[model samples]
Target: MDISTALLTFLHILIPIYWLGGDLGAFYGSTFMTDPKRSVAERMMALKILNNIDMAPRTALILAFPTGLALAWAKGWVQIPGEWVALAAVACLAWLGLAWKVHLDHGGGGGAKRLDIWIRYAMLVGLAVAGIAGLKGAIAVPLFIGIKLCILAACIALGLLVRRALVPLFGAIRTMATTGPTPETDATIIQVNEGARVLVLMIWALVLAASFLGIATPV
Candidate 1:
């Protein structure tokens, strides 16, 4: 392939990485940092990294569709249907929730942890449907189906894991404001949360491997 073609390929995949990778890292990494054994300084560093993880993926997720749609059309994937295009629009709305939370957190208002959780699941549904349906077509595309399954599985795992961590955020009105971390409450839950996130990354690694094996395009 020519340099420009290769560049297009890179851009195609890179956008999803930014969107999926960044958010997953941030959400799951925070749970890992909650261990009492870690010094406060370490916790602070983890928090900083978690913020990057949670937020950086937005850069790619936000741009990928508009750009990907153009690329898909150029590659003659199919003509755009209004309903599928509506899914893309809902994806943007889901992303806007994250952006709202980010803006609030940055501006010194309390963060929308609950809202983030809501949007997380919402986006998961959006992405999962898009990826799966993109592959499960009237005519089969084996490689595309494989790639979509990997991504969808990773997303489903991520949603499950983050949902595990979300309980504390949901209960903030009652307990989280003053309660200390117990062995049962904080540390162990985080371990499970992190483990779930690790699963997401593992699946994602598989997705990338498949992509390299020409999974994104049909034979």
Candidate 2:
């Protein structure tokens, strides 16, 4: 219960709570945005709210990696070298800064967006490799840790999938704003939002599973 361990433990618990809570807020806002009964202005407002609230979950997701690793080290569940753990924290912080820059740029593409995309792709591959290696005993780690890593990889993948699915919805929203809400545009928005919702649910499930594994460490 030293200071570093206490702080890591607090973060380990706090991140998921905010991740799930923020996601729920964003989900609700998205539902409002998709409501045909709502006026365009109202829906637009909801979309804005959703975007702002979503930062919480996105930030949590980025920070989870280093915090989880630090927690594992603190609890003696893993023997990651101290320097490696510190490097992971630094990398996570750098990623977080890149993520915020991308958010502020909002896909305007001064290179932050591209960098963020590549970073996510790199993370996806790295997590997959680490998960497989840990599970196969190439890395000396607990089964629970390996499974948690795999689950986290899945969560990241699902987040990307959700983003892809929502692209069409954004386009449709623009069209609706310009051309007025036609049936086709509304239908497209609804369909894409539904697909994104499914992927989001999967991500939430994986995150909860990872959290449970962290707490229980069930082999």
Candidate 3:
């Protein structure tokens, strides 16, 4: 491979590393955040740490698409226009900025978060379509690549589902922080986390499946 291609390949490999590693860290943090024995202040501190660690996977997710696309182009797997590839990279960077804003802004970055959600929704639709079409031979792409796209779509969908499931958990945590934990809030936190844990596991599986596709490229 050429140097640029080699570099892109290296970067693509790093994405799943950060994605999975960061997710494990955040998952670990959630335990501390939800532990009833911990002080409220300590739990809140855990939540902060979780949010910060989550940025790694968030960043890896944003970069994955463009990096994969660039690698495909470099390998002659596809013939996308340079301008379009550049545009995709730029858009991913903007999405990365918005993602950080949503995380870092204590105000919640409501509008930005909404925009980010819509973008993910759009991506989910697009990836699903492309993957299905490619698999059906309607699009000119290899089977493993098409499967990778579908895997990516599933991961994104599960991510949104996790976010949705955790909304009530966040609200409960906030209520606990201000008003102190009650049985009801504690129940909500545990219940929500339990549900989200399943979704997170599914995401982990999909990420592994994507990695396998990239490496094996089965016919």
lDDT of 2 by residue, 1-219 (tens): 899899999998998999999999998898888888999889888988999899999999998889999998988888968899999999999999988887787657668887887888888889889999999999988999888888878888888888788888877889878877888888998899889888888888888888888788886
Q: Whose TM-score is greatest here?
A: 3
Candidate 3 wrong stretches, greater than 4 Å: none
lDDT of candidate 3 over 1-219, digit per residue (tens): 789999999999999999999999999998988788888999899988988998898898889899998888788776678888899999999999988888878538689989999999999999899999989989787888888889888989999999889889878987999999988988898899889989988988999989888888675
Q: What's the TM-score of each model vs. the native?
A: 0.58, 0.95, 0.96
Model 2: CA > 4 A from native: none
Over the full model, what C-alpha lDDT does candidate 3 score relative to the true structure?
Answer: 0.88
RMSD of each: 5.6, 1.3, 1.1
Give the CA lDDT, 0 to 100, for residue 147 in model 2: 89
Q: How many backbone collisions does model 1 have?
A: 4
Better candidate number, 1 or 2, judged by lDDT: 2
Models ranked on lDDT? 3, 2, 1
Residue 54, model 3, lDDT: 86
